[model samples]
Target: MGVVVSLEDSKNRQASVKPLVDLTKGDMERVNQLILSKAGSDVQMIPEVANHLISSGGKRLRPMLTLASAAMFGYAGDSHIKLATSVEFMHTATLLHDDVVDESDLRRGKSTARTIWGNQASVLVGDFLLGQAFRMMVDVGSLDALDVLSTAASVIAEGEVLQLSVAKNMETTEDDYLQVIRAKTAALFAAAAEVGPIIAGASRAERNALKSYGMNLGLAFQLVDDVLDYGGSAAELGKNVGDDFREGKITLPVILSYRRGTPDERQFWRTAIEGGENGDENLEKALALITRYNGLGDTIARAQHYGTIARDALAPMPASALKSALLEVIDFCIERLN
Candidate 1:
């Protein structure tokens, strides 16, 4: 299908189904088993903390991406299961650290690792999980595997640093926002897709294709996440609405609102986010400003644009159910808000 048509299909599918693909049927069970096993036996305290988040039941999108990418390339070995589990371990480690850094109390509607275990314990266990992830990758026995994950780890740290530097700063540009998202989120997704072909010894073209697909999908996923923080129900989104604004983190919708708001709306932001505190009363005004400026529409459009790019990236791959599932995933990314 053409890129535009594929994008439309993704949109349509997203409206009907929350997820573009379901991983439960194939190697997903094996991958999950490996992930639990890799959490390690000794160091009961650390492993317990890691298990807390692991068992909380996230969407497990990263590992699913890894398996899907390998499947797309026609890999049948069990190594993909190990690698996918490793990807999930790395992802979980980051979240543990992220909650500590953000001083967050809630994740997936439960108390976060840091909240339950204290910051020091959460940080230490996060370190432990990161170590386990590398050890697992070493067991996988691919230098290419090391290259993808090590680079992604560095990028994730950079993204965290970038986010820390920009917090509560009104001078952040759209480019700044994109940099943070690429580092914090898109880098891992790209690695998840790229590693499959790297592991399976697929052609360079195929590797690049999967990489682009992953990057675009990651971007779309994050945009929707940011948008949902402003527009979603707390129950539906599994966190407090306006948490981004409350944390003084300006995401795409807020940035768009700041850029396009009327003079009064601009002044409201200057006081609420820049000069004054973001009070509960200001939330209505904030939402109104974004609505008036069409910030939500602009943000959603950007997400859809990335979803289109991701779907188009699948064209070079041979037709398979796995490839089709990946396309559906791109659709799910864009339609998640609805």
Candidate 2:
């Protein structure tokens, strides 16, 4: 169901993200400055909580996407900087809210903002970030760009609600899960990329191309993140491995394992996920079941499927370092499994 790259391809993938990072370096610096400025407020705790996660070493990939997508059309303006910062703020706001909703303790290998500031502070600060993001979008003065980003915000909230409805429910279908991720994860990515072309006044074909690339890339990124929850080290994930299992989150691995498992295996899952029997022993058993059913492998394969689509989405664009780097980002996302 997915294209498997050669070992040679995989080995080369390690450096894939570097070029994009290099390409966006200057713009990203401006975006970071804007982030820090906007994240601040007279309320000491607002900046305190926002900076806790912002200063935590995230890749800032979403903002970088905005920069790169703009650069692809040779855009030379300050609006991309504002838009990129807005994208980052939106992303950060979502993370703060997600940690609270998931009741998580750690993010990026540090205590979550919610853990330090309490859920109310975390939620309120998240709202503040969102308000700042929309203000920046308005400052950009582009109705189309504003429309795309605002719609993504609405879709992301819907996705969160959908995920909550399915949480710990083993009966969640693959289609249902895909819909959730598309809205929650991919919507922002699509908006980030689409706005670039909108600001640049690129053709409809180019706009659609970047949107497709971002959407598929986001899907691949999140799918790989799900796989890492079960297989990666806490150091690699920046949080404890098996947190999904502990939280009774019905990720793709659990859905696959549950549907394919034996009767006894199914009961084990029900007890562990539905009954909330998520002790250390149960987590190990869940891992065993996921591996036994090749859930992780299948999930990686699904990621590869989306990764290919993301790469192909860039094929029609003219050759440039930015385009090449974007293609390599797809490979990097998939190769993270290794």
Candidate 3:
């Protein structure tokens, strides 16, 4: 699906998430069960809407982070499972809400729940999932974990608002873009990773390290996602290739393309993104300008910068199967740009 051969980094032959998946398999099963159990409700429509998204194909990386983080510290209690389930619920809830806010028609190559159930039903179901998530968190009985996760919820909301403010605004800077992703995407990752050690009662330094790793990994992941919107296909991205452009979202590629173009090119961007001329012709033009300005390449470079930091974050930990798997996950995040 990556027709752009130039972007594919086949050199990272070792990049794979299989290790992490294998390492966390047993606990992940328990987490998945808990997720299904918690997502159910007496209200038939609740499960119907919740399962619509929950059953959709996804890597469930955030919940896996929770499991691996705790397991890394030798946490044996079942609380980690509940925490992982809670993390997944939080992530799913966010996706449901995001689809509504973005007015998206597709997710994971399927119609968004919002499209079928309607925005009001989708939103209410999202709130239900969030409520269930907090319920599971409370059951876990870790104040530190709760603190981290609750903070992340608020931060994610703030990020959404910040994104709304910047959408179609061509002046959005790289720093502004970073701030938005750190909140919306990376906050959950940071909290998910941090809670694992918190629940395990690990050293503060260890928790801090995992938190750092998760945040940087998320940043790299999102940067690559922004690149993929222009370079990837629906089969690969699990969504329409030009969804971001059609929505007038000012992602990293668009920001770079607009800021680094000729005056006429900049005007084209303003018309397409800000002035609501987001037709197929405009999307084609936007893609050309993005490729011409090396927007995808430079964004990937930025992703690599964060990937290095994420790798460094794990240096202090002793080598193990899990540690190696975690590193591979980092590589997978950046390599997805291909």
Q: Give the 10-residue window scoring lowest on summed lDDT in candidate 2.
A: 1-10
- In order, candidate lDDTs are 0.80, 0.90, 0.89
Candidate 3 on 1-338: residue-level lDDT in tens? 22262445657474778889999999999988888898888999899998888889898999999999999998989999988888899899899999999999999888999999999999999999999899989998889999999999999999999999999999999999999999999999889889999988999999999999999999999988888888887876889888888898999988998899999999999999999999887788888888889898999999999999999999999999888999989988888642
What are the per-model C-alpha RMSD values against the true structure? Answer: 4.4, 3.0, 1.4
TM-score of each: 0.92, 0.96, 0.97
User: Which sequence of candidate numbers ranks them by lDDT, best first?
Assistant: 2, 3, 1
Best by lDDT: 2
**lDDT tens per residue, model 1, 262-316:** 6777777878877657777787788877777777778888998998999889887
lDDT at 101, model 3: 93
lDDT of 2 by residue, 26-48 (tens): 89999999999999899999999
Candidate 2 accuracy as lDDT: 0.90
Model 3 clash number: 0
Off by over 4 Å in 3: 1-14
How far out, in Å, is residue 199 in model 2? 0.2
Put the candidates in TM-score order, highest first: 3, 2, 1
